[model samples]
Target: MQESVFCMVVSRTRLIQAIACFLSLYKTMDNFKVYILCVDEKCYEFLKKINFDKIVLVTISELNREDLLAIKASRKLNQYCWTLKPGFIKYILTLEESIKRVTYIDSDLFFYQNPNVIFENQPYDSVLLSSGEVFLPMYSKEVNNTIQSLTGNFNSGFISFKKDIDGLSCVNWWDKMCVDSCTSNPEDNKFGDQKYLDDMPFLFNNVYEITTQGVNIGHWNSSKYKFTVLNDTIMVNNNKLIFYHFSGFRIISKYDIRQVHEQDRVNTPFIYQIYRRALEKIINDVEKIDPDFKGYFTVDAVDDN
Candidate 1:
């Protein structure tokens, strides 16, 4: 059996969410390894104490690239985190010679089923990408085109790269591009590390786009799909929901969470309810580890109505 390897980058603010992501993955999959790149000392120290099985914690310094450090001060926290994606994936691919593929997962994602569904029939030498196209009927052609132009055709949240010539070339090029200038300046046609993914298919061979609707059901496209809970399993468009990206979902207080997308709250309340419970549990666990640790809790007011 081929080894299942995944990687993610997280900072202190996202520690709770990262742990929730790992726990979700653990519950859904039997055998897999996750490599978490800690973006801050606090996150690194906190996770080190947990010492999660099948999880490898790596510090930012361990990446050992002066280029990333040089521009760290100039980039925003999120931009810097975005910039680390490709380099981190490359580092894992090179560091683990025995592993054939490395999939990059965003810390904000929660797994609902075995992600092997995404990789099962994929070509060994291909780079797998999650489609970022919004499926809402509200989005006009012009708006969709603009979105594509700004954010690109793929979401950087879930990308799998095989340790072969084409895959290596794509990751290396992306790493170099990100190290050069990974700013969120849409005027420059650069929206951090995500927009660059638009060139992957054209620049490399065997770049496959994951067309499975359940693979990355998120706020951007969730409204277009029908979500139903059947026999205790979440189904999206008749397929078993694999994972959901909780992007922009913020915890305002212990009892208040701000679901940024109003449609998401309306269309997929069940998913959010499940995620909220998981987050509450993870937050309680985190508080036990550090009494004063408030992971990503904001003071903003949330509309309860």
Candidate 2:
């Protein structure tokens, strides 16, 4: 079996979510390796103790790049994490000559099925990008254009790069762009490392947007699909749900999770329940490793209105 390579960047604030993501992947995928870039020492130490199978833990210091270290003090924590995404993927791709492809996934993404479906029909030399197209038709053209300009036409949460000329060129350009300027300011036509993807198709050949519906089902577009559970399988518009990006979902407490997307509460309550249970179990397991481990719990009041 060909090994699938994946990478993610995580910190203490996203420790629980990252573990949940890994568990979900473990349940679904076979012959895969995940390289986790721990952005903080606490996250690194905690994951070291757990020592999950098929996972290799890395630290920010392992990068050891002068450019990244110089800007560490200037960039915000979130922006700094975003900045590391491309660099981290590039790092992994270089670490192993046998690694044919490397997919970068956000720590908050949970998989329901094998992600090989996303790679079907994709050329080995092509770069795969997740489309950020919001299926809701309620937004006007102006609103849609604004959202595209701000967030870009592609989501950076999940991107696959083949170890070929086109893929290397794309990732290298992205890494350079992010290292130079990865700010959240939209005024400069940059929204972290995400907006830089808008120029990929125009700048490079073999760049394709992933059109698989269930590949990136998330809050931004979940409202547009009719989700149903059949025979223990979650389906989105008759397609098996591959993965769900819990972009803004927050854990207010052990028993309470605040769904930031209003439409998800009404359309995908069952999905949320599954994730809640998974998170609770992950929390229990984490506590076993470190009883005092309290991370990612938010104190914000939930607004039901």
Candidate 3:
């Protein structure tokens, strides 16, 4: 009886997330409940401005209290990848609690295209993420192989899963991989947790692959693809890209040209525009929430640099 109720509740939560994902696409609301796992207060505060009441805000502290007893073992190796442990641990705990089925988008990404389609369209029991084509080579060979051993697939930016023990197991698997003391190959440390996540899909049965354009598109190496932007509509090939991950690059002002140059620069006009608009939105929204919030970026500095 308990299992049946839990399944039903998860089904409902996915529906809510589906609807929220669509609404987020339309309005670009940072208010979605799924964003509760963020460890960055500035990002969270900016999100809090737009939809103060509706943002599904959860602090790192609230999510990782020692009392949870869920993943206390991971506490010690927190040194291995402390920046990621809080969010990853929280994701595992949340999935275990049956609070919701989870999808994690990195802080460096911004949604321009509706991700609802990505969530609704896939048939897997879980979604294994890989860094988009632009960024995968940034990892070393050893890390990549280790990841494949774990998931038989590679990705980290946008992972989707149904809330269940299997999901928690996968999350736990990732936590262990991040802190694994097994080998100290110097190359593995170069990519950090991302290289560790490459093998995630193999850990469980319901694994689905999210195609290249669906998530995490940007200038790690994204120049080969053609980009077309017609007003607010952006497309790659004939199909639109869902979101662009602004990894290792910074947008100076909302309308500024991207600061990072890659071989794929000329081809991604649509993605460039998405980065511009999203950056502007984040900066503007942050000030509305906290008048005192002084972010480092300004029009002149970003434009000049």
lDDT agreement with native, every candidate: 0.83, 0.82, 0.47
**Residue 67 error for model 1, in Å?**
0.8
Number of residue pairs clashing in candidate 2, backbone atoms closer than 3 angstroms, sequence gap of 3 or more or interchain: 0
Task: Name every residue pair that clashes in candidate 2.
Answer: none
lDDT of 2 by residue, 195-239 (tens): 889899889989989876688777767777777888988898889
Once superposed on the true structure, which residue ranges of model 1 sit more than 4 Å away at CA?
Answer: 263-265, 297-305
- How well does candidate 1 score on lDDT at residue 37? 95
C-alpha-based local distance difference test score of model 3: 0.47
> What's each prediction's TM-score?
0.93, 0.92, 0.63
How does candidate 1 score on lDDT? Answer: 0.83
User: In candidate 3, where is summed lDDT lowest over 10 consecutive residues?
Assistant: 1-10
Which RMSD values do the candidates have, in order? 3.0, 2.9, 8.5
User: Model 3, stretches more than 4 Å misplaced?
Assistant: 1-32, 38-53, 65-100, 134-153, 179-186, 230-232, 251-270, 281-285, 288-291, 297-305
Instruction: Tell me the lDDT of model 1 at 245.
Output: 88
Best by TM-score: 1
Model 3, range 158-184, lDDT digits (tens) per residue?
666555566667767665665443222
Residue 40's lDDT in candidate 2: 87
State, as a TM-score between 0 and 1, how close model 3 is to the true structure.
0.63
